[model samples]
Target: MKKTIFLFAILLFISCKKEETKNESLYPEAEKSAEEKQLELGQAIFEGKGNCFSCHKPDQKIIGPSIQEIAVMYKEKNGDMVAFLKGKAEPIVDPSQYEVMKTNFAITKNLPEEELKALEAYFYSFAK
Candidate 1:
């Protein structure tokens, strides 16, 4: 029984390892889309009126975190990122870091819904 269990575990490890290596090669066209063009508009809001560039960049971390990291957290949380923006959902990634963002959300609270949608799309587009 012990030997069988060890063999099963080894097989599982190898299967999971193979999956990890194949992940990036699985998609190509989705990386660039008309939806991504909208991100350019969203990116402007993020950097300008939203002033998100003060804390975030496309690939780096600042006082908060990167947009890429947010995209990963959004996928893992299994919920709409917009709901989180509306205060309808709790933080699932780096909640300690969220506390810092908490100080700023009130400013974001007044943003128009369309703008919020654009922002959500903008952040998620990084996942592409």
Candidate 2:
């Protein structure tokens, strides 16, 4: 009887642990902070609908400045990237690329405010 009770207790402990793990997996977003969620949204926009990845790479300059470069510049200068995307602010990262980026304004200008902020957060994510 003693051995049977010990085994039952062990089994109960294992089941509880499994249940906790399952819950953590099921609601993964619940564990993410607001900033993390914003970054994810920004990444989706940059890679998908925003089409930013075509010109800007994460670490190296392609058709435009790298994300890290932009983030560092903006952080240092206190520039407003979201305002630029909205066409309310001048280009601060690469004025030479302004003409090229203008072509994308039609898409960026139409994004929801939340998405624009998310994109800004994503860019700033690379700031060191």
Candidate 3:
């Protein structure tokens, strides 16, 4: 009887531990702050539909300037990032690459206002 009880106790502990871990992993998005959620959405767009990752990286230059560089350049311009994404503003970080970016504007210019804001917020978050 004692051995059975010990085994049951061990099983219960294992079950509870598994449940705890499962819950932690299951609802990670629910636990994220608003900024985190925005960043996640922005990242998804950047990597998925926006296709910005093809030419712009978070920290390094590729075919275009890095996200960090754009963020810093626009941080003082007040809404210029959103304007650029919306095709309302000209490229300021690297005008030499503007043609490449302009060709991609069709993809970004039509984004929903909320997504544009979120993408801007995400880029600005990287500014230093």
How many residue pairs clash per model?
0, 0, 0
Candidate 3's displacement at residue 34, Å, is 1.3
Whole-model Cα lDDT of every candidate shown, in order: 0.78, 0.94, 0.86
By TM-score, how accurate is candidate 1? Answer: 0.65
- The reply for model 2, stretches above 4 Å from the true place, is 1-25
lDDT of 2 by residue, 1-128 (tens): 99999999999999999989877786788878898899999999999999999999999999999999999999999999889999999999889879998998999999999999999999999998
TM-score versus the correct structure, for each prediction: 0.65, 0.80, 0.74
Quote model 2's TM-score.
0.80
lDDT of 3 at 110: 88
Candidate 3 global lDDT: 0.86
For residue 41, model 1's alpha carbon misses the true position, in angstroms, by: 2.8
Task: Give lDDT tens digits, candidate 1, residues 79-121.
Answer: 5766777776788767877777776577567787877888888
Determine which window of 10 residues in candidate 3 has minimal summed lDDT.
75-84
Q: State the displacement of the C-alpha of residue 15, model 1, in Å, after optimal TM-score superposition.
A: 38
Off by over 4 Å in 3: 1-26
